[model samples]
Target chain A: MDKALLSTRNLHRSFGGVHAVKDVSFHVPTGAIKAVIGPNGAGKTTLFNLIAGTLTPHQGQVIFRGQPITGHKPHAVAALGIARTFQTTKLFPHMTVLENVMMGRHTRTRSGFLAGMFNAPWTWREQRQTEAKARAILEELGLTAHTNETACNLPFGRQRLVEFARALATEPSLLLLDEPAAGLNIYETQQLSQLILKIRDTGITCLVVEHDMSLVMNISDEVVVLDQGHKIAEGPPAAIQRNPEVIRVYLGDEHA
Target chain B: MRLRIYYPVLATAVLIVLLHLALAYADATYYMTQITMSAYYALVVIGLCLLMGYAGQASLGHAGFFAIGGYTAAVLTTYNLRPYADAPFVSLCRALGLTMQWKDLYGTDILSFTPWAAFGSALLLTGLIALVIGASVIRLKGHYLAMATLGFGLIVYRIALGTPVLGRADGISNVPPFHLLGSLQVNGRAPFRIQNYYLAWVVVLIAMVLALNLVHSRVGRALRSIHENEEAAHSLGVNTYRYKLAVFVLSAIFAAMGGALLTHYSGSIGPAEATVMKSVRYVAIVAVGGMANLWGAMVMGILLNFLSLRGVFGSFDDTVFGAILIMMMIFAPQGLLRVPRLRALGSLVSRRSHA
Candidate 1:
């Protein structure tokens, strides 16, 4: 069997009198789209935060590419090829869209601070290449026309795409998206599903935490349903759709 | 190659050079002296602008670095002398050939080190101190960092005031003026004030260039990203703490170099020179200028320094500076640089009417 791209082994997290997440374990295989779906306050977002290194799990091992990265700092985790998007789009609002995207390329840059300050030829050359790459990413996301605009000035849907592009610019082996379809319209959601598939085609594993069942069911290769910080069901999309637990969680027992 | 920027910069450079030469030939010592002091003050303000305005790091401890630089020069110049003497261990080490002191290693009096050496050493020392302070204190967020740095400034001020070995409250005098080459007497000769004025201006100009480059680089972009959203910056793979510390150290080095230059130019150093009030004044200078624009700092620094030299507000310089800072914060937070758009609009109208 192919090695999992990212896996959590018995993950546990608690906050004073509340067990935010407990005994959760899942493996995301390479080049697959996996969705972690849950209701409000179900710890789906907290799981993303834990995996992304924003929060530390009390007891767990986050293995990425067969290496443990449980308690590393967020930037260090990002450097190790796991990138994430915030639940609320967190673009550098004052900077131009291109600049915001370029910031994601910072880790890949080789130029030192002194070289950049002096405007060395190599620094300029690298900057030009990064800008070109950022433009290409923008073009791919249909955001090329908005590259020069401030991130805050973009429409909310476009901002969402910009965040996705920014995350993609980090060249992550695994992408963890938190509520990528939260505020998106139907068309945008469709586009996002297409983008997720495209990303998977590029050999990047995806672990998406989302609420929109239609998008998740359509795009996710496997689904893990979370309810009140515990995994209710885990299976392929069709199996998850028919699961009694998922049905009861979504629709009441009377509707189910 | 943007003429809009290049033309003004070129014009300003020419004007400053012309002014320097004219003052050298004008035979007015007092006015020339005032210009020299103004240039030094401008240098401090430029560094302050970079720290507070561009990096968005609140530092009330700049005067601490400034005072340290001054004392470094003072203690080195007075080496082994009574009252302002070197430490006993250092003196003993120097005598026993266990270690070559900085003074002995250079083989010149503290005053005679080349301007470049002074500049480099001052920057190195200041950068080292700032690195230590920044690593410890930069983790504190917002006003806590500000208050902590303010406390540092007060502590440094008190050290300068209370320590007799550092000249106590009276400070050290007869700071050896900067030596150009080995033969050229830039001080105590014909047009000495003019020479010192130009020297100080050149340092200020270099500081401004460095500050400008820093603010436009990738580091600047990273700093702004952190300023806007620290968590976002981190998620994007920015080591925000490292960047903040780097900026803090760099800003301190610039301020220290400015202080060193001022010490040499004035031929004196004092505890009062690095008071908490002095740090506040530098912040006020940055505020009066626009925080977002380096040129704003340059313009305001020169303008305010010259205004004070001309005694435009007499003993009310402090009051005036404070009032300007408050008014700018309230009404025109962007400061005088924002008014240029009006001038551009006026010119556009005039051109259309003429056509």
Candidate 2:
């Protein structure tokens, strides 16, 4: 059996009087696409932040590759090979699409202040490689034509694609995408689903928090359902669709 | 470095030469003194540009760094060690060639740290202070950062005003000339005016090359990313705090470098150099230069400092700087050169060249 690549052990968090996430435990096996689905205010985004280190879990732990990584800062988590995208695209607006992706290569590149100021030969070589890598990522995402345009000027769908290219540029083993299909059109949503599956096939595990059931059910190998900060169901995508508790949470009691 | 960045640096060198010729033709070589001083002031502005425009950090108390540099050099090079010559530390410094004996105007013998020794210590002290301040200060954003730095500047100014060893209101005077190598030296004397002018410009041009290279490379991209969206940059594994602190220290060193050089050139260091108004003037110059444009900052730094030094603003220097800050913030926040009309003109020129 494949060991879990990332696991949460009874993760718990609260804000003021409200419990954002309580006793949430799940595992993403290596090279699998796992989706966390829930209704509004169900703690999906909070859970995502906990894993990405934007928020600390008041209880329990986040384990990656069999090592505890709870409470690590966002940048430290990123350096440890966990990359994420925001629910609302947060690309550097003034930067070009290529530059935005190049930024993702920050951890991978080692040239810093002294080297940059002195124009060291190795920095020049590293920069050339960084640009080539960014361009390759853009080309793979079919964003080559838009690479030079400012990120804010791109169409919303293309902007989302750029974010994907940026996350991919980080070359993460575990990628966390928060609502990657949120504002996308139906066609864009379909393309995103295919892209997620393609990413999984490329040996990068994916843990996605998304509202679009079709996209999740289409690409996810397994699904975990949350309702009001508690796990309601966990199973294969087809099993999740038929889970009565998930149905009740998605629809009201009358529909159930 | 890219070949393109070399062009501007070369052009700046050529312009420096032409300006000297023009001044000689007009028999206005006296103006070279002010221009040389402005070049030193430009060093502080470019460093501030890196902090404010690129790294997205605001330092309202940069004059504090300048004053720290000036005061360090002033206090070290001006204090007479003749009385303590028998003391172990004084003798050690003297044995290390760090002390110089010279005659004051009254012809009395005085022993103090050499200008080179004083300059080195000034840079080291300024860098250490910036590091401590930045460790906590760079965590602040926007107005809070500005206010904190301003407070720091005020404290330095107060110390300069109240301290006895620093000369208090009288400041430090009769600082000896900085002797670089045989005959080549930094002093306000008439004979060395032309040489000092070239010396100052060469320093500015070298700083410009280093700054331009920094802004175009990987570190530059990281800084711009931080400026645009710090959260996003952090999530990409950029250590934003470390980068901010590093730039802060580097910029402080730049200001101190200018301070040390200027103090030597003018043969005096004063509490006025640490004034809040002086700090405000630097911010105004950076704003006018277009926050992110290094070349623009250098140009505006020289132009504004020269005008102010030549008494072009008469007695309204502080008022004029404050007004410029307010006006730029309200109207052309992108800076004078980066205003839409000029930006469009710039694009037009680029397009024509391409055609």
Candidate 3:
């Protein structure tokens, strides 16, 4: 492997007695697009949460860029070059798309309450720089037309794009996207796959938890198949499609 | 960019001047007393607005902070330290110029802390208390948060009413005036009323300008992000807990500053200012002014408080505020200025041109 940018070792998380993620282990190479796919209740989302620091693993470690980051808070994880989007579109509804992107620049900026309240000269300069960077991100995502519109006013697919733009504004080395295609139409899904490819080409690693099989198969450089909180298979997208175990898990026992 | 920030500030200055000129022309300068008092109350509203509006934290304990500030200043400035004049702490305070010698109503010489010392102590105590309270409670959300803060307010109220040193029901009186500079002072005497009115308004304007700057900056954006969705903000590297706690302490300081200055201006600090009703009143004014609108809160803070101070609502003052709260919650939860109908009205007129 080309030096894994992120690795989960023997991760385990449970809600009550039911194991949501059970002794799962995985790794993603630097600057690659990787996908974790499974049926409902297969522990994919739970696994993502554990890596993103939303939930602490009962056992095991998550190493990012050679450093163990297990049990860190979400914000702390984000500050260390990991950014994520929620399964649901969690855009700031009342804020404009431009402002939403600007919020992602939070950790990158240094102006605090006192500097802000006093309207310090540096804060003004920082604000302008943040605005310019945000505008550039919006343009890259082709969301410039909707820059001034409130985030919630956008259609579901467009809102997803705005969120993607926001996550990009954070300038994270690794982006964790949760169900980016959930509410998107087929056309929008295709657009999202293209965006994901563009993101990967930029040398940023992507770890995506997805449902749409075709979207995953098309864009993912490698695929990890999860079943009942266990890693059933992991390989290139082509091999995963041909794997007998993945087929059985997808089509039931008789079909296998 | 600078123009966007300066115009509103300039306009507010003009408005303040116009209001004073109009009051003087109408021979209603007597109303300035209530106006001046309202200005102080408005300070509390400004702080609460940031908490309840931008930060999306409902604090029903702001009056507790105000009382903490007022009582700290009142107790320090009025408590006789002459008996302990030889004590090291008292002598240290004297050497530091923190203590002053003045005559009481009976012409007795009394040694106490100066207004400056009292004011500094009030803010320091309020900030520390706010940090402790906020650390424990800022993690809570919605009704849980509201109830927790209400409980804090009640505790402060009880302490103010039951603590003998705070004068129980009679409260603390004989608070000395705060000397701001060479001639300017926060005093309630008739000769100082006009100057005091100007002083109070100037303080309010400075606060407003600072608040404006805050809300228009990056910190404001982060606060609004937290308000919209805390988890998402956290995912984006905004430390939601730290922001909430910081804003809580800042708002508490603002409330305490208001309380301390008002106590000095009135020459008294009372338990009534610490009551649950007072906190609710602050909440009501913020709601009526539009929760997130600083200017709206400041205006309604002064207007509603002035009316109540002038006995406009008669003996039903508390009842009137309670009713206003209920009405605003039901009829215009978005606040008077942000009512959907108002926006619809504007759009309706614009649509008429198309028709």
**lDDT of all predictions, in order shown?**
0.77, 0.91, 0.90
User: lDDT tens string, model 2, A29-93?
Assistant: 99999999999999999999999998999999999999899999889999999999999999988
Task: List model 1 lDDT by residue over B141-215, tens digit each.
Answer: 877988999998998899899988788878876656566566443353345755666666676676666665556
- Per-model DockQ: 0.42, 0.65, 0.63
lDDT, candidate 2, B65-111, per-residue tens: 99999999988998999999999999999999999999988898999
Highest lDDT against the true fold, candidate: 2
Tell the DockQ for candidate 2.
Answer: 0.65
Fnat of candidate 3 = 0.85
Worst lDDT run of 10 residues, candidate 1 chain A, spans A116-125
Error of 3 at B139 (Å): 0.2
User: Is candidate 1 or 2 superior in DockQ?
Assistant: 2
Binned by DockQ into CAPRI classes (incorrect, acceptable, medium, high), candidate 3 is medium
| Stretches > 4 Å off in candidate 1 | B1-9, B21-32, B81-121, B183-190, B332-355
lDDT of each residue in A168-256, candidate 1, tens digit only: 99899999999999888899899999999999999899999999999999999999998888998999999998898889888889766
Residue runs of model 3 more than 4 Å from their true location after superposition: B344-355
Cα lDDT of model 3 by residue, A76-116, tens digit: 99999898888998998878999999998988999999998
